[model samples]
Target: MSSISAHGLGGADDLPISGSLAIVGGTAALAISFVVLLLAWRQPRFGRAGHELAVPPPIARVLDGSWFRAGLRVMGIAFLAFMLWPALLGRNDLANPLLGVTYAWLWVGLVPLSLLFGPALRAMSPVRTLAELLDKGTGRSGGEGVVPYPAALGYWPAAIGLLTFVWLELISPSSTDVGVVRLWFAFYLAAMLLGWAVFGTTWIGRADPFEVYSTLVGRLSLWSRSASGRLVLVSPLRNLSRLRPEPGLVAVVAVLLGSTAYDSWSSSATWIRYVQSNEVDVTRLGTALMVVIILVVGTTFAVASMTTAVDTRRSARKELPRRLAHSLVPIIVGYMIAHYLTFLVEYGQQTLIQMSDPVGSGANLFGTADMEVNYWLSQNPTVLASIKVLAIVVGHVLGVMAAHDRAISLLPRRHHVVGQLALLAAMVGYTFMGLYLLFGS
Candidate 1:
């Protein structure tokens, strides 16, 4: 129940029950899914159904290993290094610059493409690679047409991670401790590998909790689309119909803010000087507000990106408006730019301020980051942060533009040329602006 102990206490004797339960549940789910899938594969009924499934043409397979695969590997390794060695390896805090960039691009741009083209992350998903390893190592295959349960239980791993993160922040906040976090990540990596044994590659594809929750929303609303088909962004409401900001995300943000608030409130000196130095308390309030804002904005961005990707994938028609056609890539890039801009603007200040005055004014901002942000900031400050932020922006733009181009090409020849040029020009202008703020200032 205690947050600190939730992730197995520093003392080997203190094991977290919640964490153990998650691992157990996840393992059980994978086992069941694997068994069922194996049975189906070996069974005549499943075998018959499997033969009826459509197969992709050879040409469609060639595009599988494009930039997406490379990008995923690069990001995964970068994240691994950053997480495993936050103190000596990565950005200013646990905020790995490369990972940040990837995240920005992925959510903004690649997600849309994945929806339109295919499962974007599958190409180089570390999870998938590990799953393949499991399949090969275990000598298991869908020989009879059984479903892959470990792959089916993909969400559990992420769920465990997310839950563990929130608990650490709110209940027993130890993410600030570098050694502890690394140990936790060790467990996380181990658990993820275990998950692969059940799910296989694209495990999350079969069971994304976000998508599942969205389906519920899709069915309830009068304006909701059938959960069966792809979503269209032509209408904003319809495009976003299934997206709901979950309370859990809010709770995560609340815990972060509340922890900071508790720190300030519990400090005798802080409260004593409250009336005399109102500005100090106000600053703490600002910090608290910032935490909540990050949670809300970050969660929203994540939801939007995932939903967009899913819808794009489901839709058979890839048509788009002349302006919006090539807009997907640029939109994602723009999102990355925006995402990093804020991160740089925030983290840069946090690091610099903390360094100059460790315990004076705003030290806690840098000092108290959970493993994710703290590790990156501590490891690589300016270079990683700047690059990551820039990458996110640039990646989003490229992805959006690429998607739009694909959509535009679907139009008549004359329309494609003119439309591409116009979109490119707009993207250039946006890029220029981003550059100016990033460097010109």
Candidate 2:
């Protein structure tokens, strides 16, 4: 088996780390949180004061033009075509591009693309494109269907969908099978279309797992649609702050982090030995473990947010988790980058090469069949390890800033510093846990 086949869903193998560096990393993360609390902006700055950088008039016009949007829809159709081609007739092994397309390309490829381009996958989602076409064909306005969406549902559906996808990837024994993945996509398509039919485009955004995932990461992108619906560049933090606080916001964030941590943990030899020693069904055990991790992590953050003093009504206090949830987005993105950077670089290339000969007929359609994937990052374990640690630390710093800014905006003046302590501690613990996953995975 190839290194990627083992580490594709898992993380990089055997990263070297110094004990001193790990300690320094943990210390720096906590110290920076305190420093930000003590000396950062007292007034709520990020609340409504995001700076927007202007694009040239022509560029803006071109970006917002119909041609660009149609092109994106075309891209969505093209991906669907790729899926149908191999999904129906391609070989069953890793040699077929279907497996790589699902795992390496789409699963891991979403991170950087969302970060740089802001929900490109969502925009180019084939299911979404088809839904829009259906809506237009039916002559609906504002993409609303016969029935309105249930406001109470919010992102809860998307949260569940995300968990389901992660469960299949991390827990299902047959996850690597091309046919299994194809069946998964088939179900995904049917579900997306059904939801889209019931609630329209709004439903797709709120209920589709990949759409929510991409849009969440897209919050970190430099480009975004402003209030007036024109695409413009803004500070990543400001973009992050603009996230719509909805039901299951914490649940979504928790699943992202917990499943990722579980992915790392599930790959360890220790976990293998534990499973081997037990007579419990692996699927049931793994499923239960993943759910427990998500609940524990999400509940921990929620409780930490409530630890601070609040003079507000109990209703407002109950909303604290949602208010503080945006603070964790950067940390999730950073950790995702930390965990998948090298894996994506290596296997992502391999996926591209496989794409050239998707059906195993030895066709060089994309002219990349002979390309060799570079392993320079793997060769220098120290550099890769350092990058992973630094990514976590930087994410920690940004998360602290977000939490601080959010506290000042919502918490009473007297509860400011003390209220943040619990959140700060949570950030510290989360960072340390992520570091341990890196060093030990």
Candidate 3:
């Protein structure tokens, strides 16, 4: 029950498994994914057709009502107010709810919320709501930017923003400090508002890191608004095709996968011992390691996706990564769940308890401050380890399916089997790397 081990809650000390077990797990992860190449639907089912389930008329009315949206926005702002208060004026101590709220709840908690509800952050974004309010207050005309957002920039800003946010989470010594959180949010809010002003609202869509991330994961959510303005319930695979191809899309995914990988790496004893023994400043070294990991992940995928040795359209080599970028979402989200599930469940409770005493006045405004977090999951490493492995395998399977769909659509027919080699290798490497981090390190 110590924060000394992991990022979000008490450390994760996984029950050690034998080398043979790890090797078997890694091979199974690859075998399961590679199975997609043999039996994958060749016609691109997801890209062409989505299996939608009808919503009953009465239920649809409630879900699509204007009041529901407004209520969510109001709730988002209220939570924003709660966290902002502690960040600004509350005690700059662990008793302050800011640490738990930011790390445990907001970042890690966004995964499940998005998976179940779809773009939960955007629906409840205080910044998005505030931006809307600011624009309306000024009575804008058409809301076009003075300078149209460049087509070339795409989500690269979001990619950079993601890296910056994760940098704060991963490397900074003052990460949990109230002043640090305040300053970080201060810069974030100011930049968001100012960017919206000059570039119009497209700036926020392109540059808003958290929103982009939430929306990315939202693709896996069962509930989504279809083209005809109806809320449709669909399978996650059916919903996967909805991700629009955009510039920097691949890079954005690369950052997500690589950063999550490094976050796990940092918790390993290998990383811990190296940082402690090194003469170089730990912060700088940590930053380097993060950057390196991100680059390595991006490079691996890019090479694998582009290196297919087939006679095909000239642009296929260039566009392959972007075309298949959606495959990484499942993997990133899966790893996120694997890495932070215990942290979120345990520390999320801790956050709720802390929120009741936001000002550190010892007053339990919600009358639930006396709650004790269940640490049983943390103690039962065997069950936890099984869940983590299963999650990684599931993610790999999903990634393979997504990639297979894209490959059939994009690659030439003759190259389909042979062409998937690089991609399959990449998925196997990525999956095994995750397992290795979980088991070996």
Question: Each prediction's TM-score against the native?
Answer: 0.33, 0.94, 0.94
Q: On TM-score, who's better, 1 or 3? A: 3
**Candidate 1 to native Cα RMSD, angstroms:** 20.2
lDDT (10s digit) by residue, model 1, range 267-368: 324344654666555444544544554354334333322322312453322212211322232333333333333344344433333332232332344444
**What residue runs in model 1 are displaced by over 4 Å at the alpha carbon?**
1-123, 142-157, 169-172, 199-341, 344-441
Q: For model 1, give the 10-residue run with minimal summed lDDT.
A: 1-10
Span of 10 residues, lowest total lDDT, candidate 3? 4-13
Per-residue accuracy of model 2 over 1-441 as CA lDDT, tens digit each: 234444532333434546456746665766676676667577887778437877678998987788998899898898779767777888887777777677667777888889889988876888888988887898987888668988888899889889888888888888778788888888888888888888888888888888888888888889877777777898888888888889888999999989988877777677889989989799998999889988988988998887764755787777888888988888888788777777778877888888888888999999999999888887777677777777888887888888888888877777787888888888888887787776654
RMSD of every candidate to native, in Å, equals: 20.2, 2.2, 2.3
lDDT (Cα atoms) of all candidates against the true structure? 0.36, 0.80, 0.80
Which sequence of candidate numbers ranks them by TM-score, best first?
2, 3, 1
Pairs that collide, model 2 = none
List runs of model 2 lying over 4 Å from the truth. 1-5, 8-17, 277-280
